[model samples]
Target: MSAITLYTGAMLQGAVITLELTAGATVVSLIAGAAGAVGRLYGPRTLKAFIFGYVETIRGLPAILQLFILYFGLTQFGIDVPAYWAAFIWLCLYGTGYAIEIFRAGLQGIPEGQHEATAALGLTRFEAMRRVIIPQAWVAMLPALTNFVVLELKNTTLVYFIGVQDIMFHARLGVSNSGQPLAIYGIAALIYIVLNGTISRVGGILEKRAAIAS
Candidate 1:
């Protein structure tokens, strides 16, 4: 096989792993972020403090360091975290910090008068949030959230550090076997470019639809 053909086949397999990891992390982060935003905004004092600290700590720390702690550091205590789960949890928590802030800003952008209006209609807090707040916040939040999603997609490359067989990992393997660092690494970079480009395009489409609806 030609060099290009061989590289393409291996990179495609790596691409699948990359996509699966990104999808899983995105889903977990979104759910966690929504709950975190809600709790930080309206929960009791202790709950707010805990959520606040979690978000801040995650945001402040380097994600690679967090992954190292989870993957290597924990082994000292006999806590064995598989490479996949370690990467998964790290990305989820890391992405969730930004997700919480995105959602919190979105929620805060809603006017207090909206809540007052909902109350005037005799709606409960849950009803007000469901019927009035969250919908608007979702639209307002999409652009930032989309940006974060793209970042998370790029961040999946970091899994290579932990020995996950992601695109970057495969590229490194190809470099070792084929002795062509530029060619292998270039292919990996191109794959990332394509994936991130597609994400940007989809995000734009969603934003347009959201704009039309609002």
Candidate 2:
């Protein structure tokens, strides 16, 4: 096979790993963000404080620093996190911080009358949120959430710093072996663009559907 063909194949293999990391991290972060937003808005004071601190701390620290702390610093205390898990965990936490704010804003955007209406109907807070508040907020939140997913997908490249064999890692390897940084790195960039483009497209479709439903 030609050198270009070999490099492309390796990069494709790496893309699969990138997809796995992105999907897992995005799903986890969305769940965490939604929970955190709800807790901050209506939970006990202590829970609110805890979620506030977590969001602040995660947002304050750089993503690379968080990954280093998990992958390397943890070993100092004998925790010994695997590289992949470390990367996955860090992305989830990082994405969740921003996601909380996005979701919180969406939730808070609902008028106070809506809350009163739910209470008047004898709906519990949880029931009201699940059945009424969240659906409205979700439509407003969809665009921001989609942007977060795209950002998370790009951030997956940082996993290579911790030795995850993701797309950028394979691209780097191919460049080192074939001494064609331009072509190899270009291909890697293209792959990321395609992946993110697809995400944005899907997000647009969802947003339109949500708007119509709302």
Candidate number achieving the greatest lDDT relative to the actual structure: 2
State residue 38's C-alpha deviation in candidate 1, in Å.
Answer: 0.8
Estimate the overall C-alpha local distance difference test score of candidate 2: 0.90
| Pairs of colliding residues, candidate 2 | none
Residue pairs with colliding backbones in model 1 are none
Worst 10 residues of 1 by lDDT: 1-10
> In model 2, where do residues sit more than 4 Å from their true spots?
none
The 10-residue segment with the lowest total lDDT in model 2: 1-10
Which lDDT tens digits does candidate 1 get at residues 110-141? 99999999999999999999989988888988
The best candidate by TM-score is 1
Give residue 27's error in model 2 in angstroms: 1.3
- Candidate 2 per-residue lDDT, tens place, 184-210, comes to 888898998899999999999999999
> TM-score of the candidate numbered 1?
0.95
Compared with the true structure, the alpha-carbon lDDT of candidate 1 equals 0.89
